[model samples]
Target: MNSILRITVCAYLLSGCTFANSEAMPYKSWRLGFSAPNYMEVWIESADVVDIKEQVYPRAMSGTAAIQTPLNNTGDPRGWPEKPGIGKGKNVTGADLPKKIYVRWQSLVEPQTYQMVINVPESTRAIMRKEEKAFCAFDGKWITDYRNALVINLAPGGMAKIWVMGSCLPAIEVTKVKAVVDPRGPYEGKSGGKYDKLSDQSKAYVEKFGVPYDSWK
Candidate 1:
């Protein structure tokens, strides 16, 4: 082949090789895992403006209750899970408790550290005229609002686990959990104002879990 034609062919081959290499490399991903007693649900709000909602059933019923977030674009949060709710009278109590209840979250994105905020209320069960309810514990301490959430660094393809433990009886079921993403480091300055500007729920979360590192502006 002539010099110019040979040069063109070599360039085309090199471009193809570059494309193949890019496709072969794995992208960054974030994942969350947890296990509970009764039915559980998780909501993921990603940095890419996507929302994911997953519901996990009991192992005894479905033979599998492991839940994972869908890696797809959800335009609006309200449009997802429009139904009323789950686990009304179907609660498992006493010896009939579920065997397995696990939830997970996974996503592919730019490699960077992220943080997770979990809400574990103190005695979600309330009795009008009954005795006070007991709280759940983790790592030898009660899982209160102050100790419910956690912050961790996640590298590419890394996974963060949050083990949930509690009773599976009626009025004591594990219903919902919210997981927010801090694309920036947990200690980075806040994009918006300080805690005052956050939503009521967020404000409550701050009160319980404390503000993230350097998050306040």
Candidate 2:
């Protein structure tokens, strides 16, 4: 082959190899799920890494940006519960009740698990244990192994299908479940300052599952 043609072919082959290597790298993927009573907002932020931007759910807080459960039968075509009392064999309809919310994200560079933190609005009244089952799609199949994931519970007042958040938790050796409640009102302490005033157990929950500062403001 001519010199120029040989060089061009070699360059193309090198580029192809590079692309293949990039594609083969197992990019990190994450899924986060949680349930709460009342309007709940979630934020995922990096603690060790300064460059990684914090992630916010619902994108915006106004209008339809808030993460919430279905409003009615028309709102939930999947037949998920739209109100509380499903466990008691009773049906109740309302906007303010326990609601489930889930968020997911993936990245080419696997995030440092220990540096990750979760933040919620200070308005959160209580964190309830999720009694229902949750699932996620992996390799085009649904995975229901809760033991392999982190679970956070909150008592938001609404009803909807199981849509829980999943993601990495820092320093978590095994799958962990955490529950927490805000002791103050939405306007209390100007952000999550109230987190510092929580009881020892509640404070430990914030340390383990939540970011150091409030992300709501």
Candidate 3:
């Protein structure tokens, strides 16, 4: 092969190409945290291709395993089995970030689907660039578990507060978006037993499985 052709092949391989000519970037797996008066459908845009959590639910501010389940990187999706070819994930830099995360909800009286987009903050992406800097305190020492996190905190009157769950870098509010409230009103529910309200089967899984840091559980 010519010198230029050989160099081109090397560059492609180094870029973390999975499918020929396809662009796959490495993303610090981040999970979705849901907190609202009523249950709403939520998903990360393009989550499947990026190895992110798609189907998910975890209390946003419980401060427990609700958002702290996977404290160890040893079980991370990209390297969980401790075996090669099992975790097929690319390692892209921060330049490939800014996943277009979207949230939508509708319940009870407020049957109209309310939608909004929460863009990833440059601050969080900056942290992902430096894995050493992103961290979370578990037991005693710090760990880089919750690096690429995204949060949704909904309130009455169609208000939403999005946050970057950077843990050690300290969680930061990324943006806030408000939708027009329906004439009926927001969905009303009790927070005291949010988990208890779930079906018996779901609650059982919650007790055993924790929503991981990298992908949405």
Candidate 4:
């Protein structure tokens, strides 16, 4: 009788007219774990962007969740039944590992010649090229442990999106995807002026591509 009463009370408490989805709340930023000295960081802007960000974790979930069990019948000690994880251990959260940074390589003027060194699978290079790419500190670093990558150049004022991929479930393996923009062709340096002000021509490009005029300029 006591057990029945406890279950009934629990059910009553849980039965509600509505429940809030914490994820649906407006999130300005999300924190993800990276190995010390090699952590990844990303800042989110809108709800639609958040939804896309959410997809990365699920892709890495299994890799993070699979913990190794002791052999020789010591009895399977899977923490997951008691405590589910976004990846390998009980501590893991639904955060994507080896974070990705996507930027809009909008053009400020009529598209000009540009160079990039994106770390993408050969398959994704064409899509990346169509988008404007930018220079990054770690672009084109040889990846000893990955397969399939490509690099390409794009037009001036064009845009390219780039990001990394990985899983940190077991503390075992992590991965990353790369798309980089390298400076190629001739680039002339101009002196400081009212550079903050966007040219009328560049402003239209920024509006059309949803990128910041100043950043692209």
The candidate scoring highest on TM-score is: 3
The better candidate by TM-score, 2 or 4, is 2
Residue by residue across 135-190, what tens digits does model 1's lDDT show?
54434443322111111211122233322222311132333333344444322333
Model 3 ranges with Cα > 4 A deviation? 1-28, 37-96, 107-112, 121-124, 132-137, 144-146, 167-169, 180-217
Candidate 1 local lDDT, residue 50 = 11
When summed lDDT is taken over every stretch of 10 residues in candidate 1, the lowest stretch is: 47-56
| Model 4: per-residue Cα lDDT over 1-217, one tens digit each | 1232234334534554232222221222232221100011011110011122222222211111122222332322211122222221121134321112222121223322222222223233222223222333356443222111111111233333222111211111122322233233112112221112334443443344432323312
Top-lDDT candidate index:
3
Whole-model lDDT, model 2: 0.23
How close to the true structure is residue 178 of candidate 3, measured as C-alpha lDDT?
A: 70
Off by over 4 Å in 1: 1-80, 84-104, 108-115, 127-217
After the best TM-score superposition of candidate 2, give how far the Cα of residue 198 lies from its true spot, in angstroms: 24
RMSD of 4: 23.2
* Model 2 residue 38 lDDT score: 21
Give the TM-score comparing model 3 with the true structure, all chains together. Answer: 0.40
Residue 88 displacement in candidate 4 (angstroms): 32
RMSD to truth, every model: 20.8, 20.0, 16.6, 23.2
